[model samples]
Target: MKKTKVKVKRLKKGSNIAVISPSNGLASVFPHIYEMGLKNLSEVFGFNMVEYPTSRMLSKDLYTNPKLRAEDIQRAFQDESIDGIICTIGGYESVRILEYLDMDIIMNHPKFIMGFSDATTFLSYFNKWGLVTFYGPSVMAGLAQMKNMDQSYEKHLKDMLLKNNKSYVYKPYKQYTNGYKDWSDPELVGQCEAFYDNENGFEFYLDDEPSEGELWGGCIEVLEFIKGTKYWPEPDFWYNKVLFFETSEEKPSPMAVGYMLRNYGIQGILNSIKGLLIARPKDYTEEEKEDLKKIVMDIMTLEFNVKDIPVVFNMDFGHTDPKLILPLGCVVRIKPKENCIELVESPYTNKNK
Candidate 1:
């Protein structure tokens, strides 16, 4: 796919932000945290909250129906009152909804769409439409962090959603909240342990010297499952692109990561990209994190032969707290020698009246 520049629009205060669930309907089951997320958006972020038909609907059978899930997303984008769209939470089966979405509607609006985990499916779709979408923090997860949202996480979100800065330096937080609180007890709402971080910053490697390219890719597992599907781009689409991906709580085995990378190599996907951003590994234990990192790096070097490819590890933009919102279709600069990564465009584009 040829690179096309789409200017992102800066949203003003008081604009209505639409919150919808395109994946699992967790909002219906966990109304406490869901409502808490709404409160933060209205009272803290100062945006009017809007909900869709299935925004808070709960059904054991709905999980198996991908059509209904896709309808909710279509309705949200068609509503002109909505200035932006956010997912309520992430879950499996989001990939199933890909066939039901109206790409024309989403591309026409070109509004800000944000989510991670399963949300990566929609993000990739939006990218194919030539629109930039966000991959980071969900409504109930990051925005509704108990006690309060992480200061750094909130800051990065505000910067991307409201401002137009071309460069943002990611900072790892010393502590993070996983949103593990007693839902039955209202008093336990805002309680969580602060995750400690001792790392200084991301480590980058430049393969063909400094290079810039359009950002692509998402959660590694999600991409693999949809690899052969129509939703995934062709081999040439990934050529010379900047690939960014992170793992989820399932804690995929190191062998699994290598297999996926090897598949990309076989498909000629690995050699086509300008850079790669592999986020910090999430596992059951700290030792597992270390083991996964070593395995991933070795695969990149040996199997993929992307030795000079600038790869940055431990960036806070995945399942971890205090995550940074990454623009999927935006131009990203990767300087491996300097150990720096910067976003060069806004994700939102103005709709001409």
Candidate 2:
């Protein structure tokens, strides 16, 4: 299949960004975070946040209803005033609304759409329609970051959303943090830092020295949730793709991760990819992390048997703090020897021109 060039438009100051609840209705339950996120957009990012019908609706029960969530997404995409869309929070039911989305409407207005975790389903849809979407910080996750947005995270996000750049380098942060605190607690809000070390960086075991291709994939659990549905692309569609995957907060067992990878191997999906990027597994215990990594390596080596494939472990992108913003369906180049990952194509067109 011929690849399409993605045009990333620049986001100017004071642009309107729509905050929609496409997954879980966290906005309804934790209105404070939603408000803080919006405030950050206006005060910090210099962008106004537009809240739709479901933005503030906090009923966990209502979130399970896919049609309602789909309506929120459709309305946001159809609105001409909104410059881009950002998800509120990620939840399991996001895949349920896959069929309800009007891809035609989304395709016509290809603006900045950002999310991760369950949002992978939407990203896959956009990829199928030849559109570029972001697999990074969400409103609640990044904008409403516990204290303030991580400097490393904020930088990459701005680069992707505001500055149309072909490629950017990612460096590990000195610290990492997560969870929420009272807004009134100034110390708590401002002092939260992530767990980071100087040793953090990209390490690739590659059969091929250097490789480049369009980047794809997201929360592995979310991808599996939408598998066999209309949202999933044909198996062969992932051929020669640079697949980037990360685990979620739930931290499923190592066996679970291995099973999923084994399935992909069985389907011949592993052999067709140009490379693979796995984020640091967010398991609770140190032992679990080791086990999960072991499981992943074993599956990739034994099941896939594509030992030469470039694979990077412990790269930040998943349910971790100080995350890097990834452009879904955008071309990225990976050099294993140099341990460098570079974006080689623009995901949007010129917005400033």
What TM-score, to 2 decimals, does candidate 1 have? 0.91
The clash numbers for all candidates, in the given order, read 8, 14
Error of 1 at 25 (Å): 1.8
What would the per-residue lDDT of candidate 1 be over residues 149-191, giving only the tens digit for each residue? 5566567667777776656655556565443556666675644
User: If scored against the real structure, what TM-score would every candidate get?
Assistant: 0.91, 0.91
Error of 1 at 39 (Å): 1.1
lDDT of each: 0.73, 0.75
lDDT of 2: 0.75
Q: What lDDT tens digits, residue by residue, belong to model 2 across residues 1-353?
A: 54464554566688888888777777776666667777777776789888877777766755667788888887777787887888887877677787788877877767778888889988777887778888887777767773465566677666767776666766555565543445455455433344546365676764658888778899998889877777677865887788888888888787888888787888788888888898877644668767876787788887667887788877878787767878888878888777788888777785554
Candidate with top lDDT is: 2
Model 2 worst lDDT window (10 residues): 189-198
